[model samples]
Target: MAQVLEFRLPDLGEGLTEAEIVRWLVEVGDVVAVDQPVVEVETAKAMVDVPCPYAGVVTARFGEEGSELPVGSPLITVAVGAPASDPDSDAGTEGSGNVLVGYGTTEAPARRRRVRREQQVPVPVNGRSAAPEVVEGPVPVISPLVRRLARENGLDLRELTGSGPDGLILRADVEYALRAAASPGRPAPALTPETTVASPATASPTPAGTRVPLKGVRGAVADKLSRSRSEIPDATCWVDADATELMRARAAMNGAGGPKISLLALLARICTAALARFPELNSTVDTAAREIVRLDAVHLGFAAQTERGLVVPVVKDAHARDAESLSAEFARLTEAARTGTLTPAELTGGTFTLNNYGVFGVDGSTPIINHPEAAMLGVGRIIPKPWVHEGELAVRQVVQLSLTFDHRVCDGGTAGGFLRYVADCVEQPAVLLRTL
Candidate 1:
């Protein structure tokens, strides 16, 4: 007799509480090896492929793609020690002890509770079998999503047979029923606004627009920005500076360089120096403690827009790194962001942010501060503009710089001083040499 083992979704750390199933790698009765990835899930941070700890025959799976499941919820069940036709390749009596986000489980229950397929039934809630009740004496059903879908469609679960293991009612069955109801000339049951279901038949005609759900990375960005707007009393100030010298300095450095230095890296170097002179900007407000806790290290965060969305990847201990190292680190993090492989650590713990919206062709923007950070510096496009140089009007490469800061941290004088220092540095890159 094979013992059944239930595998729950492991806690993907950085305070992530839930994950939505993105894809399933295995099907029922499929042979799975220990530590093999069984499903791909999207959390707030990134997409992660979750590995199964048990090596066995996959007996059942819970949740459909795009459905969210909380941490510690059963993802799949497996029959350990099940006989495999190719035992040499498929069967294993051992288990994988691999850990994910500090979670690993290989223990099987002492006494196996054999749940026969025939005994599985839909649990009743408030006299409805589709209410996700987990008791005996009801129809055999699993996921709450299936029940919710059926209930919204007014489809009686007692009538439809399930295609999943042990007559389990899957989301597909409800979808199939809903589609059948919405067939031409077939009337859809009237649904309430709160209980409405999406379908082809009774569904209202969609206009020429796409509706993308704000989930995953996009959702996280929305939540963070909203919080920053609601809680932080942020103010922005801007100045235009002659970046001709800065641009020329970069050219000369690259001309003399073995390793190319990025313009953003140079700006980051300037930011670190400014923050060092005015450490008040590198702090977070602790609302609960009624304190403004100053941070020690400069974990510099810079904005990088990817296909996924706008993400700010942090360069750890950036204040301690040279311009060359900063350029390399930024490249690595930006590539990771584009590839969607950035870990939660790489995305968090920023003391300040540099928003180079210039890349977007925008001259200037009042960018929202990344939450928990005290300030964000915004850089605009460097374009040739008429400016005064040595008391004469001339065309110079000018860039708009804006700083958005939390008023609770410092006054306008400090902010103004910081901006002036940055502008001076850009106007003359040699000014940074004194700080260096």
Candidate 2:
């Protein structure tokens, strides 16, 4: 007899409570090797492919794609020590003893799993799954929002065939049905001659703008920013700097280069130095204790905008890394952010953040501090402008620098000092040589 082992979604770490299933890699009856990725899920922090711990034939999977499952929920059922349906199948009897990333194996009780046959759907008298005119049957809908939309629209849910996994109804399906029903010259559902309702021509028209749901990365960003604004008493200080020398220094390094140094990395290097001098700016507030907590290591985060949303990928031990090392790490993390392959660990635990909105052609912005962190440094576009250089009028590369700090951690004096030091480093690259 085969022992069916239940595989639950393991703790993905970093206080992540839930994840949305993005895609499934295996189907029922497929043989899986231990430690093989079974599903891809998107958490608030990053996208991860969950691997299985046992090598066996898959019996069942829970939750459809786009459905959110709490941590430790049952993910799949695997039949171990069972003979393969196909003679050539090679699922092993033993387990890999592997676990999800950032988790450790511990004492878990032996699980007993029961399998049941799927219910069979009846074919209509016409020998079809659905009728010719409309898809009439029990609708498969899970989201309460979908239910509410259908109820309010006076549309029969049975008339629609869900486009989601296993014919499951989705919010989009409900919205599409609504748009279709409201379309002019088309008939509406549940409208009888006795019923008095707004006609298609008079019914409130759907807005022309597309309604994208604030979910996934976009939702996570909104939540964090809202919390930051609500909890932290933040203030911003800015200074204009001449980056002419800094640009030339970068050109010289790249011209003689082994690896090209990015302007963002140089600014990051300056930020770490500035933090060293004014360590108070590199701290977070302990609200419960009513004390300011200064951090020792500089896990510097840089804001990078991608198709998913704005993500800040943190560089670990940034203070220990030189310009070359910082450049390499920035390149690696930015690429991971672009490809949506960054791990949760890569996205969290930042002591400070650096925002370079210059790429977006902006002059300056009062950046919201990433929650629990003390400060954020914002850099603006560096453009050629008339400036007094060496006691003479000259055109130089000028840029704006903005620092937003948690007022609870430091006053304006400390924030101003940090920003001034960073500006000095930017205007005169030699200022960093002294610190280096």
Candidate 3:
């Protein structure tokens, strides 16, 4: 008796309804192991490879490449066990979260997975899959950003090799090409300047031009920002603090071999301590329950801005972690955001959020609140300025802090006091030691 398995598209988070099939790793009639890479789907957040949840011969592909399939749709069918007319064989409610990428529930498959794929191979250094037959070509190797910059600067892309990681071209490469062209070094290559210009001498007229689909991370970011701004009633407050002591503490703790400690880690510690002193700042306004729910555990949300958009990946039980542990977890979560490898579990259940805009020289700006979470803190860049200490002028390092909270639940007094407490902790980080 052979068992048949049906693979359905699962929820890809942010409540996505559909996704485009970028590529299929396996084809019909291929004998695949359980949890083998079956297909790659482009969601609003990233391009993800979903594994086969059960082992069997590939029987059918319900969709084709580049097709957009709605979440909860049947993607493939494999005979893994005795075939049955009833579809209830896999309909176990306990495993609904196991749906394939871009597929959601309500269209869930009613079967328990006998096995699921576990290992995944990342995209190769060449920015393409490791499949055979791709030969070396003179294609310009520039980063996606550098490619955009080159086009904006009217530089030919074919003339430069990327100098960045994995042969990714940099903006400097394009600048070099421009400088070389302006001088007597070499004649510039013939290229089309106007994007829409057509020549009468071509062998074939360019077919109706293709438009790059705005489907993945880019599209999702636009939608989320739009929703967050329109729905959330946000109020922001900014405070300035002397961070001289914080900076000195960081300098003294720089060890040659241990995990790198950063000011953000210390700030996170301060924020968690402040949350304990004032639990109201750490509560979430649960709309469904029509009440504000204060979480017992301190799961700090680290807001990361990637090329895809803004994401807040949570560090579970942040209150329980020391400086070193928080630093390690922060590094891991940051890498996860950049590589788009964060699981749905790490992306959810944030009690309080923090965004470090100071790294980009932003002194202060109103940050949008992550939905359901009542507030978020923004850390600004530190600068040296003169300050009056005991009525004497002295140079001091000062940093700015901003807090944005939902006005529906928190009053101005409560929010202001919370920001004051955070500022106090940052100015004198020793204030956090007592809470610990």
Candidate 4:
């Protein structure tokens, strides 16, 4: 006997409640395999592909295309019979839904949204648009959203294929086409020194002097920040550090294979190492649980400033890696952040965070802790100045470090010691070599 099993939306990331269904990967009557892309949901951070948990013919779609659904809501149905118990397992047969326990599992349908299906046109392999690609078997294809973007932008899916697995068209392809169109007859925009002017070639030089409406990531960041600042009691501490040795060491190590090590990498490595000595700083204050949850690993967050807003992508287990490894990982995370390519894992699980405003030539800044995490380290630009050396005046490169911590969970002494530890590592680069 055949049985129909319902699949529900899973938690895309920590603390994520709901997501908008950007598009459906499979429709009613379509056959789908377990772990196949069944839907694409857009959360505040990024667009995530929701995979099928059960293998069977798609009996019904729970939510309509372009509708927001809460986590654990029925997403689709699959038929399971003489099959593997674990649906997410890579067994020959697609088993019951692989919805992970605890994070969330789909239950019976709560309420149904009006379903809508968009026409999908498939481009033939011969580089022509003949007929829609009729998806057969269990292989997932381009989502309806990507197809719609292709149509709206006059982008021939044949001209540019997908970088996604199994040749599936992705949102990136559509965005790339849009960017190319916008840059026509204009010089490719480069990052300018001034944040006041974003993409100098795109906008008029004359200031619009008009307030823009908030939406999307910008709106979300603004709302979240407002709540964090107004509701949470935050405290900050500042320390001036001598970074002369670090600057020289980084320049000397530039001839290596890794990504050009950045100052942020240096600071992150120091902070991670310091956390091992002071595990109390590597913790989160769980308000609901009324406990300070101390984490074992050092998952450092990089406070990346993008055109959309600030996004902190966590680099898991930074303490386990070396300086060069940390540098390469930091580069990868920030690049993904700017290009909007970060996955759910990369965007969450931050035990501590670092924000670099020193690049902007700012001497020091009190940055807000990315929250839950007890502390955030902000580094300023390195500038040459006169200092005491061997009882004589000398010019040395110095940078300021600002540390913000949750006073509710930590005292001034703990915060001070953490800052001093970072300062010692920055002042003497050789200290890190000894620890590593």
Best by TM-score: 2
Q: Per-residue alpha-carbon lDDT of model 2 for 143-178, expressed as tens digits?
A: 433554676467666666677898787777777777
At residue 289, give the lDDT of candidate 3: 75
How accurate locally, in lDDT, is each candidate?
A: 0.81, 0.81, 0.70, 0.70
Per-residue CA lDDT of model 3 for 175-233, tens digit only, reads: 67766666756756432211334445655776544244455656666676677688768
Worst 10 residues of 4 by lDDT: 107-116
Candidate 4 clash pair list? 53-97, 122-132, 358-380, 358-381
Question: What TM-score would each prediction reach against the true structure?
Answer: 0.74, 0.76, 0.70, 0.64
- Between 1 and 4, whose lDDT is larger? 1
List runs of model 3 lying over 4 Å from the truth: 1-5, 12-14, 45-47, 62-67, 79-214, 255-257
Q: Clashing residue pairs, candidate 1? A: 121-139, 121-140, 122-139, 122-140
lDDT of 1 by residue, 258-360 (tens): 8999999999999999999999999999999989999999999999987567888999999999989999999999998886677778888899999999998
What TM value does model 2 have? 0.76
Off by over 4 Å in 1: 90-93, 96-98, 101-210
| Deviation of model 2 at 214, angstroms | 2.9
